[model samples]
Target: MELTVERGDLTTVAADAIVNAANSSLLGGGGVDGAIHAAAGPRLLAACRELRRTTLPDGLPVGDAVATPGFDLPAPWVIHTVGPNRHAGETDPGLLASCFARSLDVAADLRARTVAFPAVSAGVYGWAADDVARAAVAAVRSWDDENPAALDEVRFVLFNDVLLEAFDAALVAA
Candidate 1:
């Protein structure tokens, strides 16, 4: 599989699937999650509510992932995962890594050829961009190694120069 880091909006990525850095509630909040909900339209929220009413009444736990239609967004699928909250003392790197690994697992199950991801937990969750980059690169590269050619491409769609540099540097270091 090919892995590339690009500076772009996650919602605009035309990959087969995009990962949402969502809150546990999955109802939609600020940053990437809110952007995704807005772009996907109200049907996305309705789907999330249905999920809550049925299988996910307790909310999605950090590091786990679930899929939903992309709705009005560019991609066909959205894999939502809750990132560990640093302020809440959930700073474990394993949890952060699980967010990447589980998202890939979900994408593979969906038979998606390409997937786009944001910097999970690096923003409002307050994880350091550099550390989050390292963990994300490690998790994705490890997954790629274990399941060669499982995905055609994996794009880390960074929002700005700093995030791009962090992920790019991690890829280089790998």
Candidate 2:
């Protein structure tokens, strides 16, 4: 897979799928999750609600991911994954790493050629930007290596120049 780092709003990306840094509820919350739900319109919420009523009755587990229709967003599919919250005492780096890997697994299963991702757990979840960058890059790269030709592209959509730079460096280091 080709890895690219770009500083922009993930909501506007036109990839095959976009990964949301979601709360376990998958209903909708702040940051990237809220922005995606807003851009994707009410139909997105309806899909999530259906998911809650069915497959994810107890809510999505941290580090795992599920796919839903993107509705109004440019992408056809939205993959939601809950990152472990450090403030809530779920501080395992492996869990954070799994968020990236598992999202790719879900995307590959959906036959997504391109997938966009936010810096999961780096915002209100209290993870340092650089640390999140390292974990994201490492996991994504590892997944690509383990499953060659499974995904055509993976974009890390960052919000600012600082995070963009950090992810770029992490990609290089990986």
Candidate 3:
């Protein structure tokens, strides 16, 4: 697996799959979730509406990710993942790390070599960007060690230069 850090729009990554930092409901909301939905158009919402009330682990709160055509974005599929809420402490870090791990798991299962991730839990969820970057890089590194060929490339798409700097520092330290 290859690791990369970048500042880009998750809605515009031209990869096999892009992960959406979703709410527990899996319904469309603001930040990355809203951007993905808007880019994928109405069909994405229609598809997600069919999957209401999907369940996962108690603390994790992720739903079974559903694939949709990236109607407007460059990616072929969009993967929706619900991360833990803010104020969750180290417990939140665990759950957020799981979000990246599970998203990559799904991508590998689908034979996707490349995937893109937004800064999960850093938007409306209020997770510290630095912490999220550390947890995400750790999770990806661990996952890569276990499944060396599972991912050929992974990009951390930061929306702003500050976040880019944060991820860059974290990656260097990782």
Candidate 4:
């Protein structure tokens, strides 16, 4: 799979699937989660609510992922994964890495060719940007190695220059 990093709005990226850095609640909180929900319109929230009523009554766990129709967003699907909250003492790097891995797994299961991801856990969740970048790059690379041809492209759609640079450097280092 091809990997690319760019400073852009994840909500506007044209891809088969977009990953939402969602809180466990999935009802839509701040950062990328709120933005995605807003962009996708109220149907996204309804879908999440239905999921909560049916499959995920206790909310999604950190490092696990689930999908919903993208609604009004550009993508066809939205893969929601909760990243570990470092400030809450959930400091395992593996948990952070699992966000990316599980999201990709969900995307592959949907047969999505192109996926766009925000910097999961880097913003508001309190993880260091470089750490997030490294973990994300490594996870995607490892998944691609194991599941070759499952995806055509994986784009890191960062919100700012710092994240874009961090992901670009991580991609180079990987």
Candidate 5:
């Protein structure tokens, strides 16, 4: 598997699947979640609502992931993962790592070769960019080690230079 980091809008990044740093509700919220939902249009919300109404009546759990069709976006699929909120006392790095690993698992289930991810838990969620980067890269590397041929490329589509720098440093150090 190949790993890369690029500064760009996650919503516009071209990939077979994109990972949304979604809230537990899987409903539209701030940051990456809002952007992806907005880019994916109304169908995405409808799909999410259906998931909530049936499968996820309570809400998605932190560090867990689920997939939905990317209705109006470039990617055909959206893998939604709930990142742990630091403000809510969810400071476990393992939980943060699970977000990435589970998203990759979901992508592999969809048979997607290329996947794009945002800086999960970094924005508004209160995790530092460097911490998020390290946990993300480590999880992806560990996943790749286990599923060597499952994916072709995994791109960290960061929204800012700070995140790009953090992920790049993590990649180099890894």
Candidate 6:
């Protein structure tokens, strides 16, 4: 898969699927979560609630992922993953990494050719953006090795310039 760092609106991406960094509840919150909720409209929220009601295993908490319609975004689907909030320390780091892994796993299952992801848990969750950038790239690389052509294009979609730079640097280093 091809990986690139870019600063753009996630709602505008033309990928097959977009990964949303969401809270555990999957109910709307600030940062990227809020942006996605607003752009996807009410239907996305209802869809999330319905999915939550049945799909997820009980007491699983965050660090898991679920897929649903993109609602108002250009993409056909949205894969929502609940990232660690950084309070759980190194264990949280692995949980954060799982968010990326799980999202790509879903993309592979869905036969998605393109997927866009925001820096998971970097903003409101408070993980250093640069560090999370490296973790994200690593997770994608690991998943890509197993899935092969699951995704021809994977974008690290950053909303801000600083995040873009950090992701770019991490990807280049990788």
- Each model's number of backbone clashes? 0, 0, 0, 0, 0, 0
Cα-lDDT of candidate 3: 0.80
lDDT of 4 by residue, 20-131 (tens): 9999989999989999999999999999999999999999999999999999999999999999999899899999999999999999999999999999999788999999
Q: After aligning candidate 4 to the native by TM-score, how far in Å is the CA of 173 from where it should be?
A: 0.5
lDDT of 1 by residue, 6-106 (tens): 99899999999999999999999999999999999999999999988999999999999999999999999999999998999998999999999999999
Better of 2 and 3 by lDDT: 2
Question: Of the pair 3 and 5, which is ahead by TM-score?
Answer: 5
TM-score of each: 0.99, 0.98, 0.89, 0.99, 0.99, 0.93
Give the worst 10-residue stretch by lDDT in candidate 2. 160-169
Count of clashing pairs, candidate 1:
0
Tens digit per residue, CA lDDT, model 5, 70-127:
9999999999999999999999999999999999999999999999999999979999
- Whose lDDT is higher: candidate 3's or candidate 5's? 5
Tell me how far candidate 4 lies from the true structure as C-alpha RMSD in angstroms. 0.5
How many times do residue backbones clash in model 2? 0
Please give the RMSD to the true structure for each candidate, in Å: 0.6, 0.7, 2.8, 0.5, 0.5, 1.6
In candidate 1 the C-alpha lDDT for residue 138 amounts to 96
**lDDT of residue 90 for candidate 5:** 99
What lDDT would each prediction earn against the true structure?
Answer: 0.96, 0.95, 0.80, 0.96, 0.96, 0.85
Clashing pairs in 4: none
lDDT tens per residue, model 3, 51-140? 663443232255335455566678877877877667544344778888888888888878888999988888667777898889889989
